[model samples]
Target: MKAWLLNDFGLDNLQPGETPTPTPKPGELLVKVGAVSLNFRDKAIVDGIYEPASVPKPLIPVSDAAGTVVAIGEGVTRFKVGDRVNSHLYSTWIDGAPLPDAPAHCVGMPLPGGLAEFMIIHETSAVAAPGNMTDEEASTLPIAALTAWYSLVDYADIKAGQTVLVQGTGGVSVFAVQIAKALGARVIATSSNDENLAKIAALGADALINYRKTPAWDTEALNLTDGLGADVVLDVAGGDGINQSVQATKAGGKIAQIGFLGGQTAALDLMPLIFRQTTIRGIAVGTRTSFERMNAFLNDHVIRPVIDTVYSFDQAREAYEHLTRGAFGKIVIKID
Candidate 1:
């Protein structure tokens, strides 16, 4: 099977090549990949910035993908040929908390991921996608949507009438806005431009802030929420937004830390957190159960993933470069 293999840790090292098409063992399924989505982490892996030192040599990168089941191995009863599925980010963590190997067992990391013609994954690993979505849309779910859902629903227990703040217009951030609105919370989205702000509002964001224009967007969030601050803040900007997210959040509110788009580390003040009794959680993309639950929500709400662009499978390298430059919504690759 043809694949974009990471021979060395660099974008130039990603070459078009052929590897053996994997055969499903017992309790597994072979999927004919239809599309793959690019996340910021995929670019980091190619650029040698993502340090998951355990992945084996000659890796297939890009974690999230949607495909059709072409073959089912013995004891694989959950799905069969023709079933459409997406690869789970964590193969071993079926439910609940992260399993011991979950970090190392992630797709596009230790496992041969979906940027290939086919993939052999465990039957219990992935879940059915929303019926209304195209394969490209479903490809965005495994990481981006699941991360947003886990942060808003599982961690914060968001409710109606609450103000939820989401930073930037990245994949997880957009998904966070949609999920928060679906759960009845009023969403406040931040972006640097008027165009992205309008798009965010179309996705049900009740309030919008031009973070670039208004550097003190935290104070703005507080003002929008009637000086009470947000009940939940999805901080996708990492170091750049940590202090401000603390300021935007209500006392006893939760902050779900999901990405490092800004900087990896930040100097934080513990005094405000102590005084406000706020909680901060570091969210990794969630388990298969959470993926399934997220799908259920998408299916019910008929929420389509906002795709910014699509590239052909052969243009994988160009796709990586584009993703590194950043996009307003999820970028996908169609496997033809």
Candidate 2:
């Protein structure tokens, strides 16, 4: 089998190589990968900057993939050879509160992930893809989309007629916008570029804020909400901007901490929590239950992921480079 291996934990360490494909163990299934989606963490893993832990060497590095099951282990009853499935990022956490090994159980990290033509995962670690979704679209559900779903639906108590603020144009932010709109919430989307903000607006954003131009985007968001502030704020940036997020959030509103796309380890002010009574929750990607629920929501709403670009399997490195450049949506690699 042809696979991209991280011979070492640096950007230059990725090399094209061949490896033997493993047969599924009992209670496992072998998937012939049709597509894989790149996440910001994949770039961090390559650059040796991902914060969860140092890069695991000699491994395939992508968590989200969708493909057709070609072989199933003897004890696997839930899925068959012909079923279409996508990986559910966490191998241990099925649902509810996360476990201590949740981060370690992630694909592309401590375990082999979805950067190759085939993957053998435990049957419990796979979710059936919706029939209406293309492989490329299903490939995106496991990580980015799941995180967004958890932040908006599971973590936050968002309701119709409420306003939700999503930061930037990345995968999670875009999904938040789409999901919030589907739930009848007014969306305020932020981006540095007008072009991207325009695109966000076209995707049903009720208001747009160019954070670069409007340096005080929090104040702007508050003003747009008629000074009441946003009912929910999906803060993807974890740098110094968290202060702004707190300011942008309404009193008693919810702020779901999705990711630190801007930077990790920000100096925070606690006054907002004390005075405003806002709830700020930190979240990793979700459990398998969240993954399934998200797929059902997507299928019912007929919402397809906003794919920014697609590269062939051979262009995996280029896909990583493109992901590092920070595109407006999910970046996918299509396998033959």
Candidate 3:
């Protein structure tokens, strides 16, 4: 089988290579990967920044994929041959809270990933792909979509008419906007680009903030919400901006800390958190159960994922490069 392999910890090391096709063991499925989506973590892994000591060299590097089950192991029951499925990010996290060993068991890291033509997946670690979506679209769900869903639905228990402030036009933020709208909540989107903000508006964002134009976007968010602030603020930038996120969030509201695009550490102010009782919850991707629930919600709302670009399997390197350049939504690699 053909695949891209990371010979070492660098983007240049991710070159095309040959590998044997893997067969499923008991309670597993052999999926013919149709498409794989790139995430920030994928880039981090390639650059050797995300848990570099733990990453196995000569590994395939992509966490989320969608494909057809070509074969199933002896005990497999959830899916059979010919069923479409999406790869779960965590191989061990089945339901509820994530298991202690979840981080060590992720796909595209210690385990082989979807960059290959075929890969083995445990039956419990795969979910039925949405019937209405193509493989490219479904490939975006395991991390970006599920993170947004887990943030707004599972943690926040977001109700209709509540305000959700989506940080930017990245994959998770776009999904956050669409999901928040589907849940009947008003969405306020922030982007450095006005064109991107307009695009977000087309996706049902109630208000748009050009963070570049209005440097104090937190104050703008408060004004947009009649000075009460957003019911939930999806804070992707974890640097100094996190302080602004607290200001943007309504009293007693939640801040879903999803990404660290700005920087890893921040000098966070505790006064507002203490006074307002704001909850800053760190968001891991999500559980298998949460992925299933998100799929159902997507089907009900007819919300398709926003795809920024799709590269061929051979163009995997280019796809990673594009990810670093920043994407409006998701970047996918199609295996044909």
Candidate 4:
């Protein structure tokens, strides 16, 4: 089998190598990987910046994948041969609360990932891919799409006719917009690029703000909602931007803290948070059960993942580069 290995912590170190095809252990499944999706975290892992002390050298580095089950180990009953499945990012968190060591058990970091032609996944950590989607489309669900769903549906308990504010045109933000619209919520999307804002508007966003033009986009959000604020805000940008999220959210509304593109550390004011009783929920992908529920939603809504680019298996390095260059939605690598 052929796979890309991160010999050291750098994009240049991610080179293709030969490895033996792995056999599934008890309660596991050996999958023929059809596609692997790149996330912002994948880039940080390659740069040795995301918990570098824990990431192992010569590791496979991608968390989300869509594949076909070729063989199932003994005692595996959840799925059988010839099933199309998506890998769960949190390999051990089956349902309910996450495991204490969920970060250590995550795929593409401490655990081997699906960058290879074939990879082994615990049967409990795999979910049936939506039948309407292709492998490349399904590959984006495990992290980006599920994070959006978990944040809006599970954390916020979003209702129809509510207003959702999503920041930027990144993978998770795009997914959030689509999912919010599918659930009958009005969407407000923010992007520095007017072109990207227009693109998101085409995807059913009720309002668009060019954050670059209007630096105080939070105020714009309030204006869009008639001096009230968004019912739910997806705060993909952390750091001082958290203050903006607090201002953009309506009283008693929820804010999903999903990413740290701005920066990790933040010194937020306590006054507004207390006054508004805003809930800032931290999202770390989601559990396997949540993934299954999200898949059902995708199937019901017929929501298609917005793919920005798809690279061949041999172009894994280029795929990572594209992630850094930024994209409108997800970037995928087809494992041929």
Residue 9 error, candidate 2, Å: 2.3
lDDT of 1 by residue, 170-229 (tens): 899999988888899999999998899998998899999998899999999999988889
Best by lDDT: 3
* Runs in model 1 lying further than 4 Å from the true structure: none
Give stretches of model 4 more than 4 Å off. none
> What tens digits encode model 2's per-residue C-alpha lDDT throughout 260-296?
7768888889987779998888878888988999999
TM-score of each: 0.97, 0.97, 0.98, 0.98
Give one digit per residue, the lDDT tens place, for model 3 in 107-223: 999788999899888999899999999999999999999999999999999999999999999999999999999999999999999889989999999999999999999999999
* lDDT of model 4, residue 325: 89
lDDT of 3 at 37: 96
lDDT of model 2 at position 121: 77
lDDT of 3: 0.93
Model 2 ranges with Cα > 4 A deviation? 51-54
Residue pairs with clashing backbones, model 4: none
Greater lDDT among 1 and 3 belongs to: 3
lDDT (C-alpha, whole model) for all candidates: 0.89, 0.88, 0.93, 0.92
lDDT (Cα, 0-100) at 107 in candidate 1: 88
